[model samples]
Target: MKLFQYDNFPQVTGSRVSLRQILETDIKDLIEISFYDAIRAETVQQAAEMQSKINQDYLDGNSIHWGIVDNANHNIVGTCGYYRGLDKGEGELGCVLLSQYYGQGYMTEGMSLAIDFGLHTLGLKRIWAATGQQNGPAIKLLERLNFVKTADLNDDEIEYELQK
Candidate 1:
């Protein structure tokens, strides 16, 4: 599929959180996540590599990443976005939030807005999300959004697809 290029990016928000395109100003937030051990423990990846991957994704047309911010405190508490791959009109959703915000449902709100932008604005037909089978919260969120499990790709990971 061809890459979708935009001269300007868009911002999405909800009552508890707001999402803006990742910018240089957001680097500090990324750095903070890089040093958060809990994030690494949950995702099973090192910070340096993950940080580099985030930056590279912005430079390339392979993904659109955003800063998920806490509205009341105005602090960036997580990251979310659609990685550009798979098939045309299809994308993937993933997010990493600070441990403190786990039970607040902030991530769910951010992702719902993202899904709307992908479908209504970006003209996406299908969006899929993959998560470790052991990650109950993620699986539940995807299921809540009606993303169906297609198969077990490997290990504890399951693939989900949303067709428009």
Candidate 2:
């Protein structure tokens, strides 16, 4: 599918948090969260750069990305987005959570909304996501959302997909 804006991104309310589109001011919060872990610095930097580009893309009509925020504190805890894939019916899903919010159910809640929005609102037939094989929490969350293992590229990463 073609990339688009998440201004219409699903406004899902869970027990503790909410999901909404990524905002321009969110860049600073993202910059802060991206620096939380030393070992992941290089990887985080690359991801941050990609996020900046995606933010611009969203602004320019290229894609949809959303910020996962805590409803109570109004703090951004993570991001999720759908990048256009090679096929009309396919799109890529991705997300990252702040270290402080790790182990919380936030990512799961956010990703569920993303997938639902992609399928129902965005008219995507297939949504896929990949994560480092060692990212146990992400893997578990994706699986919980009914994302099935579609490919195992290597020991380092696994590809998952959900078909509508």
Candidate 3:
């Protein structure tokens, strides 16, 4: 349980969502669920390609990614991951949800799972997240998760940090 030490992204389950590795069969759902993700894919091929690169990062021992699947319908609703900070005992947190699933507490539960894994299983001393100041829901979600507003990176971007 050290930084960047996991080979396979562990699967975690919550009442509403399950966090697990995004599989090849999930590319279609991944494309549909991605909205606020840094990489957007309009087609399954594109999503597969993007995920291949991400999977490579994980294999290279540099990153960790999880697909947020709703347990009810068993469909992917979002994604979440940790960007390792080398051996610094910290990682950056990131997540994105399909617009249709917003305000339903899905991301909240999803993030809570990721946060617990990052802190307890991964042994990270801190998990930091950055979001646009205009993203009210994300800001509220972070606050609700007990992540403290730590800094304003710029006029538009703000950063929050959670520690254990």
Q: How many residue pairs clash in each candidate?
A: 1, 1, 0
Question: lDDT, candidate 1, residue 43?
Answer: 35
Q: By lDDT, highest first, what's the ranking?
A: 3, 1, 2
Candidate 2 per-residue lDDT over residues 30-100, each given as its tens digit: 76444221223345455566566765666665566678888889899997777557246667888889888
In angstroms, give how far residue 41 of model 2 lies from its true place: 7.7
lDDT of each: 0.74, 0.72, 0.82
List the lowest-lDDT window of 10 residues for candidate 1.
Answer: 35-44
Candidate 1: residue 84 Cα off by (Å): 3.4
Off by over 4 Å in 1: 23-53
- Model 1 RMSD vs true structure: 4.2
Write the residue-wise lDDT of candidate 1 on 64-135 in tens digits.
778888889887878888875534767887777777778788888888888998888777878888889899
Superior candidate under lDDT, 1 versus 3: 3
Off by over 4 Å in 3: 1-8, 32-37
- lDDT by residue (tens digit), candidate 3, 73-140: 99888898886663677788888898788888988999999989878887778899999999998999
Model 1 steric clash pairs: 133-156
Q: Rank the candidates by TM-score, best first.
A: 3, 1, 2
Best by lDDT: 3
Q: Residue 150 deviation, candidate 2, in Å?
A: 1.0
